[model samples]
Target: MQRKKLSHQVRVSTEDSELFRQSVTGARPLMQDKIAPVSKPGKKKARQAVNLSQNEQQLFFFSDGYEGFVSNSASLSYVQPGDDPHLAGRLKRAEFQPQVVLDLHGLTQQQAKTELAGLLAYCQQQQFNCACVIHGKGLGILARKVPNWLIQHPNVRAFHTAPKSWGKHGALLLLLKINQPELALR
Candidate 1:
């Protein structure tokens, strides 16, 4: 059976319209208290007073300093002059236990650089000689850039690939030089 549908229309009366208008017009805005503006977090003050070039500052702020392919293999060892020969061997053999471990697996380039800088600074302040960084073997971004960053750090003496048990090519063992002035006071 076919049924006819009826449409209903809503209409506002003049009194209701007048009342709504009056209500709207009579309502006052809520009072708002003034709030002090919050200051954004500023860049951390450098531990040392040395001035950095504009390029260097930009490097720290923007990139991890890895421009392109690194020449060395991840397994290759490194030892700076005046450093113990056994240090490289020890790092390769996983001899010196790492007091701190920083993992940069999922971090972006900038984040990894910032964290690496902070960790190295903390390690230096605490007089820690050895630390481990797990950069992973993703697109080789961190693996390549982390080494470059470590090289730029003043306290970093040498760094080498971790052994098989300690993450192999994906991690590095860092040897940090103690701050001479701080050491002299001890």
Candidate 2:
């Protein structure tokens, strides 16, 4: 026995087609103004777009010791050995107020390192328990570098990404080691 192939065609009514067209037209914007044409290319601007000033360039030139580190992930975190196990959780909860805040936005790597070192020194001298560093989530350079720098700093006991209200992944909450005097008092 031989089997025969069957074919079928579907059609829409003229009214249905007209209604669909009208719906699309009605949903479109009524304004028909043409966009202004882009100006013809003129003499090419300088290829090197250096936005940094002399001082900023100097700072960038001084960046050293950050050669081998790469950004691991957006949700990076760290806690020193023997530090409070709950430190990361509390940071996530925003339980502690930042005694000092450093915004490292728009700074080159060296500039940021210098500022961070100064901030840590200041916090250590003042015996601050916590500080917040807002390192924006730009190209992740700072994000990666900050963690590595913090790991090397003697004062940082723990650090983690800030909570939602505290700049989230773009910021870090650092728990500084208590001063010897303060520890003795306790």
Candidate 3:
């Protein structure tokens, strides 16, 4: 490597050097010490098997029973019977922005299910109106399974294939049920 020299060298005059030394005549020397960064360990929650909801548990209960056949490229969508028919349309149009997103790109089916449960549960817990689930991968297995599994979640009001801006065919936009519990009568 070639070193570039300064265009002009700076030289301090003897009078200027004497004035600098006089300015800090009584300064104390600083102690040389190095501090090792200490990071506190976070509280670890108990590691236990994730308990699936009754509807979710049924996924494992049925042996080739039926989840309704869905073609790989078909648009996955649904709105609960009593819900506003337009709710699904809103999702289709990407009107409501997803507040939280869960991506299942690299997860296995079982792992995806557990993570999906957590995402939905969190949405309900936080009373989120919309959430997105991205399941993009080489195969469309997750794309088909996620929507079918969502159809059974009670807290889900409606769901539709996400808009192009939201992952298009590789994702789903969810309209979750907002729960507001009454603390007491004022």
Candidate 4:
């Protein structure tokens, strides 16, 4: 035997959507918090590369928002770059290692901006000197946008592609720009 199907008519209106649009239109624009910009016009920006003389103590390796050892406090002194090598080698072989590795692969551009802003803030607050951003190889997803945005942020001291051991070209090593207290210590 075949069963008869019963259906009821449903009514819908755009009232909720219309109200949301109205509210959005009435909302004021968010004011951005201002800060001093790094690498200002005509000012040369400094790169963070540990030289041979800087290898007085072994810098620790930390990642994924966790704290870790600074390796051997004594070996820290030996983590310096010998000479004209690439930036990745310098950072990877530095006495101190980066403390964070932010995975940006799944983030949309808006998400990247928001997360990166938070990461920069965190790096500053925690006195973290270095960070890694895994943006992945440009398969056309984020591509140029992510790297360019990182360079433009004021709190970013330095950023470049990571070495093979440090995540290869899919990641970026980020240096936290030192502020008054941190700068005074250096």
Candidate 5:
């Protein structure tokens, strides 16, 4: 028997080969272009974690250490003469009544340091007996740094973590200069 050669048409069908070539050319750019990067969530709590409720009071400190509060206070009407940079001024309106507590969870380390000092001076000058400091239970933001500094401050009669209902590990109840609890009344 004689050997026979395969027909050219048998090697590759024209229409199929053209289709394969078109697909390969069309997909080349997709392979060459860099893929879009995917974003990863931070280990820290989500934005919802820090958002406040309807009745929740706002407390924020500026880069210069000026504090702002969202509640009303009777003491806000008693204004001191001369401009004071550290004083909250209108920002001090947050409710500071004996039972009502304010949170300080959002301050940065440096802001908290200044806030601690300003608070001590406020107690020494105006005579507040008790105050709350909300220092959010982050990585040693307040547990180590704030307490260490508070230990040496003059007006800090006592300071401890707040009750669970108020802020738990996220806040502190500061007993200001005890002798002047009456000043808070003035």
Candidate 6:
């Protein structure tokens, strides 16, 4: 009896569905067909990669003359103008884990600059919001240059000196822009 009832319900549902489909068959689709085009999620990421790779020079240029002087304090912190003012503080508290890391341990200044540019571009391309930059608070040249360069980049949202477990004063936890157009540099 239960099987009969189930079959009956299925038959009724199939008949109703067929009727509904027939009723809609005579109705014309919208003339404009105003649906916007949307790329697949994977394609979107690939497109970003292509855009960054193709137009990288114009996208990420860090100038030493961007600022005459940036303080070299052990506690480094920065936040882009329109971003959350407390972002650096939140980063220091380890609210977001760094998904990628770029270590400048023994690289020359020129090498470091190249690596920095590539890392920043790659982060944007890959849609990574958080990354760690281990500048190794050395004789202060790399540390100082690193922060200055970072501040100049339009995409760096916020950054703070890494906490004890991450790298302490020797590294910085960076909040990078992900899947968003960069804010104009100040």
For each candidate in turn, give its C-alpha RMSD to the true structure in angstroms: 9.1, 15.9, 8.6, 20.6, 16.6, 16.1
Look at candidate 4 and give me any clashing residue pairs.
55-77, 55-78, 56-77, 57-76, 57-77, 58-75, 58-76, 59-95, 59-96, 60-70
Model 5 vs. true fold: TM: 0.40
Cα TM-score per model: 0.59, 0.59, 0.64, 0.47, 0.40, 0.63
Which is the better candidate, 3 or 5, if ranked by lDDT? Answer: 3
2 or 5, greater by TM-score: 2
Off by over 4 Å in 3: 1-66, 69-73
| Candidate 6: segments with Cα more than 4 A from true spot | 1-60, 180-186
Please tell me which predicted candidate would have the highest TM-score against the true structure. Answer: 3
Looking at candidate 2, the ten consecutive residues that score lowest on lDDT are: 49-58
Give one digit per residue, the lDDT tens place, for model 6 in 107-178.
998778877887887787788989999988668678888888888887889989998888888888999877
Between the candidate structures 2 and 5, which one is better when assessed by lDDT?
Answer: 2
Task: State the weakest 10-residue window (summed lDDT) of model 5.
Answer: 54-63
Count of clashes, each model: 0, 0, 0, 10, 3, 0
Candidate 1 per-residue lDDT, tens place, 6-27, comes to: 6976799999999989889967
lDDT of 4 by residue, 44-98 (tens): 7883433322221111121223322232321111122332334434665543467
Ranking by lDDT: 6, 3, 2, 1, 4, 5
lDDT of 1: 0.74
Candidate 5, 111-175: lDDT as tens digits: 56655555555554555666776777677545555555554454545555555554655666665
Tens digits of per-residue lDDT, candidate 3, 55-111, equal 364344222334863645567778987989999888898889999998899998887
Cα error, residue 112 of model 3, in Å, equals: 0.2
C-alpha lDDT of all candidate models, in order:
0.74, 0.76, 0.80, 0.56, 0.49, 0.80
- lDDT value for model 4: 0.56
